[model samples]
Target: MPTPSYPPKPSPGDRIAVVSPSSGLPGLFPRPYELGLARLREEFGLEPVEYPATRRMGATPQERADDLHAAFADPEVKAVVASIGGDDQITVLPLLDRELLRSCPKPFFGWSDNTNLLAFLYDCGVVGYHGGSVMCELGRPGAMHPMTAESLRAALFTSGPYELRPAERWNDVDRDWADPATFESEPRSRPGGGWSWINADRVVEGRSWGGNLEILSWLLMADRAIARDESAYDGGVLILETSEELPGATEVFRILRCMGERGLLRRFPALLTARAKSWSFERPNNPQQAARYAADQRAAVERALRAYAPDTMAVFDVDFGHTDPQLVIPYGGTVRVDGPARRITVTY
Candidate 1:
């Protein structure tokens, strides 16, 4: 595939489309959604314009696709951001008018289920951002994470190479958005264990691909947004992260195993696995359990890569997805993974 082109960055006062391509949780829980919008205006100095389906629950796939089409087609909307990610965005992919998006080519920011759109945009030859959902990162309960804010601002305004730094402290814990206390202060965070590296001898520079692991599994199963030939991904940086619905180590290994079986694992020489999200409302794991969870996840990744792509350089706990102080990663854009230098840089 050809190198995808990035759309122009949005100016501070420019209007940005905020759409819900997946779930309309914004309507159900407006607290974080509203707070996210406020921050977009106050912190980023950008105006967020919402489409009809942005907050509409049970919106049809066509309706969601329409919102995306409108967002990209609108001349005034410089960028498009997802309100949040959901489970069923793959269904909306077929409803999208590819020609419309191909022509308009606006910058899109999202992760998780939004991986569907990011992969779609990549196939369409337009670069999209893999992180920065409004509800999760922007609508963060208390204040925006300093690292997240800085990474987001750079991705939004700048158009150059940006180096990613490991978060000194990161949080995987969650707060009840409905509870007023959640917004009172920052969520407690633990000291970062730091990134774990395997095969740290070389540097690899290439375009980026991949997203939430479970979502990518679904995409691979459905054969959506994936290139017809696995070779299309050769030299691309593979980024993978687990969501709040944390899949166990065995499950993680199974997904990667499938990718390997399909000849996908050998295509990329560098991999960036995100910090595992161990705690959720449904399963409130203590710090000890969280530590074990992350350790197991790391081992699972190593096992998969060892079996499939033994020489691939891999880094874990990089804090890019489903974790606090998340960094922004460019999908279909350039990423340089320097294992020898212990540095990762992305071209926005």
Candidate 2:
């Protein structure tokens, strides 16, 4: 595969396309959608353009593909952002015009189900961002988390090596997006525990890959974004995070074991496991329960790494998943993991 290329950065006043390539929850929850768009204009100083299918629930894969094509093909739209992620983006991937996206590559920002598109773009040799959705992070109720906003600004406008910092305080519990009161204040948070590291003695640099674990598992089962040759991931940084669905430790192990069986785990020399999301609306875990959940999830990851790629350096709880104050990671772009120095830097 050819080395991936970085898309040109957009200026402050440039237009950005906001599309719903997965779910059109924007129609049901216009509050976050409107707030996100408003932030793009007021906070980020960029105009956000939406497509017809953006807010239309139950949009077909073909319709979603059309929105993606239109967003990337328009020269005026400097960047493409997902309104929010949904479960069915994997269905939309096969319908995309690879040639069109490759020819007119632009910075794409999204996470969760948008992992499908990010991985697809990686295969096409274009680096797409792995965080920064309009609704969840940008339209984040009260205001954009300070760290999230700062990191996003840097990723959008600048081109350089940006060091990532662990969040001082983080929240995994979500407030009701429908409740007007949810937008009045920031979500409750707890003091953040620092990152956990294993085999932390060397500095490794490579192209970044991986996203929501569940999404990647689906892609692997379908044999979609995964390269047939496992060697394609050699020297790549594998960054993964679980979703609010909260897959158990056993399930996590099974997925990594499958990746190991495919000869994928051994290819990457480094991994960044995102902070596991332990709380959800259905299972509102207390602080202690949440901690235990995170601990168990970390143990599962370590077990898999020890069995498959013992020498691969690992870092856990880097706060780039379902956690609040998420940072944007560059998919298929450069990531430098400095273990001894306890630092991580990604090329924007």
Candidate 3:
């Protein structure tokens, strides 16, 4: 793989594309979408430009690809942001015009299903951001989390190393977007105990890789953007997080085991696992249940690593992925994991 470079960052007045490369939850939940757009303009001072398929749910794969092409190919659009995530973005991968995106690269920010595009862009030799979806982060109910806002501000306009910090208070429970009352207050959170490190004897710095665990499994099964040469990931820091779907512990272990079988797990010297999302409307477990859920997931990860990459350094409960107060992780960009100092930094 060629060295991936960061795309030019967007300026305050620049027009940034807001496309739903996955799902158009914007149409259904206009409250958060509009709030997010307002924050983009008022708080971030950037103009958000939406495409035709952005608000149209069930848009075909070709239509989504066209929007991606238009956004990346347009010189006026300095960046691309996803409105929200969906389940089937993998379908749009093959339809994408790699040459077009490669020739006209721009910073793209999103997570979850957007992992597909971020992975694709990384393969195209362009670094893409792996957090800050419009509806979820920017449109967060009440005020944006202070840590999240500060981190995003630095990422959007700055070009230097920014350290990642654990949220003082973090939340995994989500409010009902369908209820207007949900937007009336901030999501409740509990005190964060900070990151837990495993095998923190040395520092590791390398290009970052990985995203939503479930989506990556899909990509691996389809033989998509993952590098054909296992050596491509040598020395890279692996980032993994589960989604709102909350796959079982056994499933998570099985997925990583498969990656290890393919010789992909042992290459990374360090790993950063996003704080596990423990709550969802479909399976709303109580506090005790949620705690057990997270513990089980962590145990599952440890089991897989013991069987494969036992030497790798692992950090758990870093604030990113499906949790509130998400941090923007650069896909294919350089990351510095200082285990001895207990610090993590990424270049934008």
Cα lDDT of model 3 by residue, 1-348, tens digit? 667898889889999999999998999999999999999999999999999999999899999999999999889999999999999999999999988988998999999999999999988899989898899999999988888888888888999999998888999999889999999999999988799999999999999999999999999999999887769889999999999999999999999999899888899999999999999999899989999999999999999999999999999999988998899888999999999999999998
Query: In candidate 2, what are the lDDT values of residues 1-348, reduced to their tens digit?
Result: 667889999999999999999999999999988999999999999999999899999999999999999999999999999999989999998999989999999999999999999999998889999999999998998889999998899889999999999998998999888899889988878898888899999999999999999999999999897766667789999999999999999999999999888888899999999989999998899888988988899899989998999999999999789999899999999999999999999999
Question: In model 3, how large is the Cα lDDT of residue 255?
Answer: 100
Give candidate 2 misplaced runs (Cα > 4 Å). Answer: none
Q: List the candidate 1 regions with Cα displacement exceeding 4 Å.
A: none
For all predictions, the C-alpha RMSD in Å is 0.9, 0.7, 0.7
TM-score of each: 0.99, 0.99, 0.99
Worst 10 residues of 3 by lDDT: 225-234
lDDT of 3 at 1: 65
Cα lDDT of model 1 by residue, 1-348, tens digit: 556889889999999999999999999989899999999999999999999999999999999999999899999999999999999999999888887988899889999999999999998889999889898899998799999999999999999999999999998888888887888888898888788898999999999999999999999999898887668799999999999998999999999999999889999999999989999999899889988988899899999998999999998889899999999999999999999999999999
- lDDT of prediction 1: 0.93
